[model samples]
Target: MSVGTIVAVCVGNGGVPKHPVAEAKVGPDGLEGDRHRYHLHGGRDRALCLLSVDEVRSLEADGVRVAGPGAFGENLLIDGLDFSALRAGDRLLVRADDTPIELELFDVREPCATLRRIDRRFPDLMLGRSGFMARVLGEGTLRAELAIERP
Candidate 1:
């Protein structure tokens, strides 16, 4: 099983660059209070957005300056698990409070125009390294620094 930890939990009202949070309630439609600017974003099959820590560092190395977690519009920034190599239907079990949140990878998260706000090259740079879009198979509360298992 692939193991990792959720280094950052992020949420936003309605746009790119989500802000980190201490904890968040995750449901079928993703983090409560998190808003997607477009309908193409949030749905049963595309509820949550996930990014890898290394991907952020890689972007930085390539000259794409990132503000922080959620800068790519990701809802969860995991430190070890890289979903890019995982296929659709792969699952990640987030060890939350009392219940674990199970998420299924479904698709690559598409970048929106808002990403240009970070940098003109930011949007294109995020192409394959952007992250994955996942749906909550099991819901629960998630906080920063929690363990995540890809099983």
Candidate 2:
């Protein structure tokens, strides 16, 4: 019953405020053009960040104004997956265009001050809803509307 699809792909050259992109190259380091301000943000174990559309919607319903996908610095926005149910050691297989990419969840992404700066209540509102940090298991190009497999 592994079923999910990528709804958006986002990347930023430096830090927070990542914007949606049509596609991106994912490597062992991370999204090709993306950069991290602190060492905590990027590395083999935290190469990519993922967030669920349902989580964002839930936040919005709670009166938190989310600017939309990428606002939380997520590299991939997926739909139909219960992000909360996923834990460390879980793996995700993505079929991006003709390329296949694999990622393993390492830990939950903690909300940062930057996220709180975006909205005063963001920190508390996004406490456990931030998303997950993952390491790249395979390199490939990722794009929106791609299918995602969880096993």
Which clashing pairs does model 1 show? none
Instruction: Write candidate 1's Cα lDDT for 16-126 as tens digits.
Output: 779999888889988987998788888889888888999889888888877888888889898988565688788889888788888999987777778888888757877
Residue lDDT tens for model 2, 1-151: 4778999889886566788988888888989888888889889999999999988888888877778778888899999887877999999889776777889999999888778767788677888788899999888998998988886
Error of 1 at 23 (Å): 0.5
Worst 10 residues of 2 by lDDT: 114-123
The stretch of ten residues in a row with the least summed lDDT in candidate 1 is 80-89
TM-score of 1: 0.94
Q: Which candidate wins on lDDT?
A: 2
* Candidate 1 regions with alpha-carbon error over 4 angstroms: none
Q: In model 2, state the lDDT of residue 74.
A: 89
